[model samples]
Target chain A: MLRSPRAIPYLLLLPSIVVIAAVVLVPVLVSLWSSFTPYNLTRPATLFTFVGWRNYQRLFANADFWWAFGRTLVFVTVALNLELVFGLALALLVNRVTTGRKTIRTIMMFPMMFSPILVGFQFKYVFNDSVGILNNALFSLGLITRPIPWLVNGALANFSILAAEIWMSTSIFAILLLSGLLALPQDPIEAAKVDGCNPVQVFRHITLPFLMPFIYIAMTIRSLDVARAYDMVRIMTNGGPAGRTELLWTLIARVGYQNSQMGMANAMGYVSILTSIAFTFYFYRKLSLSRRYMGGAE
Target chain B: MAEVHLSKVVKRYGALEIVHGIDLDIAHNEFVVLVGPSGCGKSTTLRMIAGLEEISGGTISIGDRVVNSLPPRARNISMVFQNYALYPHMTVRENLGFGLKIARQSPAVIEQRVNEAADILGLSPLMDRLPANLSGGQRQRVAMGRAIVRNPDVFLFDEPLSNLDAKLRGQMRVEIKKLHQRVKTTVVYVTHDQVEAMTLADRIVIMRDGHIEQVGTPIDLFERPVNTFVAGFIGSPPMNQLEAMIGSRPAGPVAVLADGTELPLPPEFAGRVTADQAVIVGFRPENLYPAGHGIPAAGQTLDMDRTVSLSEPLGTETMLFLDFGGREVQAKMLNPRLVAPGERMPFKLDLGHLHVFDRASGKSLRA
Candidate 1:
């Protein structure tokens, strides 16, 4: 019996399908099933037990978990907005550099080249109160007589983490938005200038609107990056100082591995997934709206 | 009051100068076309007048004020770009009114001006549509509407119709002429197409290598071109140019052709040529035709009994190609007839309509 042409196509796809099922589908489905159980990573036999809604109930009652979730939301929102502003400014300035443009573009990507872990360690030393460079410079400049606790105080610690996060990722937005700026057609910009628009008005009406879709894309990517703010925060703060810098991932990591309450950690993880989904959906909607204005698909 | 004047305007890029110093004066309500081949700086001249390009030297004045240092908006001129340049994010109505809005006009006045322009260009229905939604021809109309809405001192067009299909270009050409008539604004149009310049311009400025070759009315350029470049560039199926030495004939002075065909020079070129002097003689295809068929073969005839190499029938007339002066010279047959390739044919070159250019400098010898 000879194999048909239809069977050959399916035969060619068999390897990819099997790999996807083993690598992606199985792990996702197993994790989803484990979220409904009171399974402990240390006690393998507990995976057989089913305790519906118990972990979720404990997570709901735990005010600390709720605070971490809310704080992460605020963190992502504030950090992303600030990144957008700085990135747009950087891109605008870089776009105007007629000479050595390629060199400037390469220089803009220098911050993005550093690992987030290294960045965290770097900022941790800079924010150290006793002998850090910042406090010493301030003391020498007569700006501050006392050594300020940059990483100890609640507001100051959060600001320090945000500053590190922004410094680490703002280049991503600048690079993406720079590509968008370069791709923008020159005709409309010239047309706007001839239409009596001053430079500010031209930017507000023509350049910014053209860059909206790109902005939303950068926002979506940065939101996801800030939401998973683990390695940097863990190295720098470890969610200490009265849980002042505690975020979803930091809290979940402690409960899952350190405290060994995997069931409750998985429950909190499921709830935190909602925030990422909301941001992605909102950015997608905004992106499509801007694209539609550009005469692409609605 | 909106006359435009350019006095010794020059353009340079670093050490390499592009446009040489040239002067021109455009009257109010006049349509002047800057016509030239590519890289001739015709577009640069238009851009300088529009204030998009800085003039390296000299001055450009629109109406009364010198607009050398003024911005494009301050110069009070509107331009239609080659690509239409309609704002993609805005509706046609918004695109048309954008200029007025930036000028800080009242809402009612902006709306009225926009509507009037839209009405003139038949763009009322497409006003709500984006430029992406409009056809090429429709987009061009909206671009025109945008220019018209401003009611500026002058209108500049940088080959606006070059992007359209040939049929659409012909249609839009008439529309633009009618638009100028209705609006009565000074228009400085630039095009590489001589036909467009001939049909639409009150005066045509021929440019070459950034220098103004000649400036004249359409008929003036057609009838009295200053050089071989203009004679060849200004006409379709361009004038045939042949290098020849002036050979003396007892009857009169004759031009010894490249293929050794001796033809008497036109009477108008008597003093301009002497025996053994090298000159380039040109005659349009329309002036050469099958003998005894076109314009009665007046003055003198240089007869050629040659084989028809190819014939292109253009419905009303036929163009016959024959070997002359070691190259193919075209002759127009006004009355169309069936003539096959390799068929023997006799044609006559019309001496009365000859153009004689000096060989070394390509300048016309006709006074």
Candidate 2:
């Protein structure tokens, strides 16, 4: 059977197919099945007991779960948008630099080089209320007599986490957008200049439209990455100080692992998957639309 | 309309100079073509006049205004680039009107100008189509329409028809000439094709090695080139040049070839040549023709019998190659008949249309 020409392609793909089935499809199916049962990790025999819609019904009624879901939505939105704006600015500025560009580009990628866990630790030390570098610097300047509680307050903690996430991920957007800027043809820009466009008008009319596809692509990748903002958030606050900064990921982790409530957590996980899908679908549609507008391959 | 004048203009990149100091004057509403081979500073000179490149030394003035400091927009000149440069994202109508929109023109004026240019370029049918959706010729028309809508002081074309196919290029050449006639603006065009220069220019400026070799009307350059370079550069198949020594014969002065073939010099250069003076004898292919199959000569002629090495029929005429003084020389036959190789035929060289150049300087020795 393997000697046939039509079977050769499937034969070559056999290893990857087997690995994907074992690692991805099997685990996903198991979790999906477990979401319908009251499967506790401590009692493995309870995995067979079915409790259809019970975990989902409780998740809908739980106000803490809704608050975490809403907070996660806000976090992903704010982080992705701010990252896009700052990244575009960085790409444009670096593109204008004619000299020592390689050195500057390498330096620009420094933030993206550090792992998210390390970034979380670094920001945690920076935002510590009593002894952080930010408050200490403010004290040395005589600007503040007392330490500001950066990571303790409700709104300030969210802002601190946002700042850390933005710092760690904005370079992703910049690098991608910079590649787009580099590939842009110089003829259109020169033509715009000769057509009586000022620099601002040139950017607004020519440069920005040409960069739309790249912006959408960056937004798509960053949105999916930001929707799963768990490691850094867990390291920084651990959903602490009366759960002011409780996001869906931390909430689900606490319920699924710490409390050994795997069924409820799997239900939450299934619902959160909707947000990632929605974001990916929306951005891909926008990417294709912008690409079509630029007369690129659809 | 504005007349463009450049006085000793120079261009330098860092410490290396590319365009040496050169002077040229283009009259108002005249079509002047700057033509040369590749890397000959023709495009660079056009860019300098368009204010796209800064001149290192000397001044460029358009209509008595020294526009050295002004940007391309303030210069009020429109240029069609070689690549068309149509905005890929914009429709044809928007691409045509973008300049006026940027200048803060109102909707009515912009629409009027855009529609007028679109009608002129036959782009009204493709107004809503993006550049990528249009064919190559249509894109080129949009580029021209974009330049025309501005109604600029002068029109600069930088090899604008180079991207088109042969048929489209020929069509665009005629269209450009018609455009100049209808618009009547000062036009400065650049191309490397001598045929384009000959057909389109009122006066053609030939450049080589960053220097202006000659500036004349097409017919003037064709009839009396200042040097061998222009003679070879401006004609189809190029003029044939032979190295010879001037010798005194009993009848008059003759150019003696290496193989001892003596051809009578033109009457105008009778007093210019001395015995044993080395010179280059030049004549166009039409002047060297088969003996009985050419235009009736009005002056002295030199006849030779040579074997035809090759013959190329060009529909209206045939180009015959034969050995003359040990080198291949091309001769034309009008109302041509097929003549095979190794056939001996009599050829005539018209001394009335002969060109003599100094061997060392390559400059025409014509009075």
Best by lDDT: 2
Per-prediction TM-score to the true structure, in the order listed: 0.96, 0.95
Error of 1 at B327 (Å): 2.8
Pairs of residues at least 3 apart in sequence or in different chains that clash in candidate 2: none
What is candidate 2's lDDT per residue for B262-362, written digit by digit as tens? 88887799898888988998999999899888896898788888899999999899999998965898999988999999989999888899888989999
What value does the lDDT take at residue A42 in candidate 2? 100
lDDT (tens digit, per residue) of candidate 1 on B1-367: 8999999999999988989999999999999999999999999999999888999999999998999999887888999999887888899999999999899999999999999999999999988998878888999999999998998899999999998999999999999999999999999999999999999999999999999999999999998889999998898888898998888887888888888988787777888787888899898898888876567665777777889999999987888898888788888988778889998888888888888888989899888
Q: What's the lDDT for residue B362 in model 2?
A: 94
Clashes (backbone N, CA, C under 3 Å), per candidate, total 0, 0
Q: What is candidate 1's lDDT per residue for A69-146, written digit by digit as tens? A: 889999998999999999999999999999998999898899888888999999999999988888999999999989
- Give the Å shift of residue B57 in candidate 1: 1.4
Off by over 4 Å in 2: A1-16, A293-298
Judge the docking of candidate 2 as incorrect, acceptable, medium or high.
medium
Q: How far is candidate 1 from the true structure (C-alpha RMSD, Å)?
A: 2.3
Let me know the DockQ for model 1: 0.47
